[model samples]
Target: MTETADAVTTGTERPDFPLDRRRCPLAVPQEYERMREENPLAPVTNRMTGKPVWALTRYRDVRQVLGDPSMSSNARNPSYPAQFHVPEEMLPYIAFPFPAMDPPEHTVRRRMVIPEFTAARINKLRPRMQQIVDTQIDQMLAKGGPLDLMAELALPVPALLFCEMLGVDPVHIGYFRRYAETTTGRDSTQEAVAGAIAEMDEFLDELITEKTKNPGDDLLSRIAARLPDEPTLEHEDLVAIARVLVIAGSDTTANVVSLGTVVLLEHPEQLAELKADPSLWPGAVEELLRFLSILDSATVRVATHDVEVSGGTIRQGEGVLALNGAANWDPERFPEPDRFDIHRNAEGHLAFSYGNHMCPGANLARMQLETVFRTLFERIPELRLAADVDKLSYMFDAHAYGLHELPVTW
Candidate 1:
């Protein structure tokens, strides 16, 4: 017989907790508060398509779920309904790569990327990251007052940094931008997303071909050189590898820059303190990352078998979301999770996440932000948001997160 209403797991059936939960994190303006109060480990029906999902709101629970081995991220199952409703053009490509893979296959492909992402290796990109940041600052200063920080500082830093790391021409960042924005966040029509993916594939194919003949000192060339040795990585696998590195390399950090700037602006005293003491800039970057941990879902993981999680139970083959933002805000971890203090030792925040699949470009991201922060304060000491704080745009309502635009000026 079919499971009756009384047969639902736990004492009571999960409340629908009907939130818009559309292309954004969840419906309703005060989401963080509601999630914390309504259900620390709240069970809610997937409002996007009326499916079932467990929304882990508390910081401890989110971390436990993310780090848990039982959770699985396989999206190929026919029975598994879509957890997010994204524009057709961007849906196929967003939030895949290592974040969505299970082990063995995941481990195989990720090995090619791990060494390249090591703290030592990424640190080598520091000087180059500084150059890109300095160049953008010069341009922004030339424009005088009233500039869109997103365009002036945020976009260019990562765009140039990623292009350099990939050994591609920055002039063609527009190509990646279309795909990045559509898939990472923002809206894209079906045709637009499809075309973007096709174009991206074509770009990757050509890049791999070019790198094949003339490998450079960059990560792309290194990954390509290593690909032949790894039995699991195929030509398509190479392309997928590059696809995520480029898109994520550009998008995730750009959002950090965009949103982090706003955070600094919101707290001017902290901004002034950071400007006066450059040593505090690194700490400031970490604090901003934790405060505005824009990337909504830390990582998408799935269970290989049924497992009992922190305090809840997730059946095997189930999808789980880890909240980097939530963990950063855990009072147990941070003395005052909500308070933004640059002086605070913010090194432990999982803004970059932890595990074998941690962000490959975290060093590059930190470098870009560091350079931007140093140069920006030197240039525009009075930098502040031009638009009302509430008017700023948020990102990746589906499975991902960040900002759309951060309109700021001196």
Candidate 2:
């Protein structure tokens, strides 16, 4: 691996933890590389607040910090590293999802929905998922000519799947999509986000009420069934879980699909190779996830106890963020990390994160990505970008980095 010649080896602290969108669409922030080498536990100021927090960069250091129980995932803790500043008025909507809860709370909450995303459950959904992919492709093909794949395919597939998973009516997808987009949008105001949250909670509350009376086999129904027995899993808990699952299930997967398409198109040689070998699609999906590392701020924690990392101590009550993108791109972890190799064994990359709080729907995401890429290539062998790469718009401020629209034609 070639050395990062300009890596900072002294004067560790940087002002902002995560540098804004890189000039090059596919490149990682330069600050990450410098910090990984010089200051694995770099102290940086959170952009949302002027408060200081530790940003862990190196692969080993990041992995250690995430798995360490001393690093609390409880967002209720005031020291928790929030992605954006939450206005005092919006505090009621700050309910902790399973991912943000600590210990027994997280474990109990996680188990409630674990059955829905099990390997068997995902396997059962595969046939329907394929049909979803085919139907979307059919619509795109019928429309013909220059099309935005982001609108026509990537966004719809996951959104519709999420609707199906939650037993939400297809007609209400527009409402759901709006709230999902705004919640993760960097440009949205706290008031706008709070409004979205309130609207979504109101919707979920109604859904839960309906499910309680007339239950189905869908995820919401299952949660409803558990409500009577699981006292901790109350009405509000169910609503919060549903909201988080829908937003996460739709947003992250959609971004991956859009960004993955961009990566494959940019590297035609690799794209062609995958097209020739259908079996390679699964590995290709894993590689793309590892290579992309779209959700840069997925894992943030506050220290519950003084934890020593790379010779420094993260004192109790201090906030920390594990830079998953840096870990995925670390040369020590992924050799020649910058090279986008479809066949690379990227099994352990931190794309879905690691340890207890690893993304619950990781398997579901993998299946969707594999099916979408394979089906797309098989259907449109000549597909290429309709717009110039440099001119394309990207959602730089989004929690997930992805193309705003990928204009493509066959």
Best by lDDT: 2
Quote the positional error of residue 48 for candidate 1 in Å: 5.2
Show how many residue pairs clash in every candidate, following the order shown: 13, 0
For model 2 the TM-score comes to 0.95
- Candidate 1 error regions (>4 Å): 1-29, 47-49, 78-96, 186-192, 396-400
After TM-score superposition, the amount by which residue 139's alpha carbon in candidate 1 deviates from its true location, in angstroms, is 1.1
For 1-410, candidate 1 gives per-residue lDDT tens digits of 12221235566555542332333321222354556665555455543435555555566676666666666555544223343344435445553465557677778878888787677877887887777777888887788767677777787788887788788988888778767776643235556655676778888989898998999988789988997798767777888788878777667777777767777777888788877888888888888777766664545555566556444566655545455666677667777777888888887677777665567667767777788777778877877777886656666353345556777677
What local lDDT score does residue 227 receive in model 1, on the 0 to 100 scale? Answer: 77
lDDT by residue for model 2 (1-410), tens: 11121232346445765566557777667677877888777777766655678888888988998888888988777777777557745455577578888879888778888888999999999999999999999999999969999889998998888889999888887787787778877777888887888888898889999998999989989978987877766788888888888778667888889888888999999888998899999989998988888887778888888788877878878888898988888999999988999879999989888899998899899989999999999999899999888778888877678878899998
lDDT of 2: 0.83
| Top TM-score prediction, candidate number | 2
Among all windows of 10 consecutive residues in model 1, the one with the lowest summed lDDT is 20-29
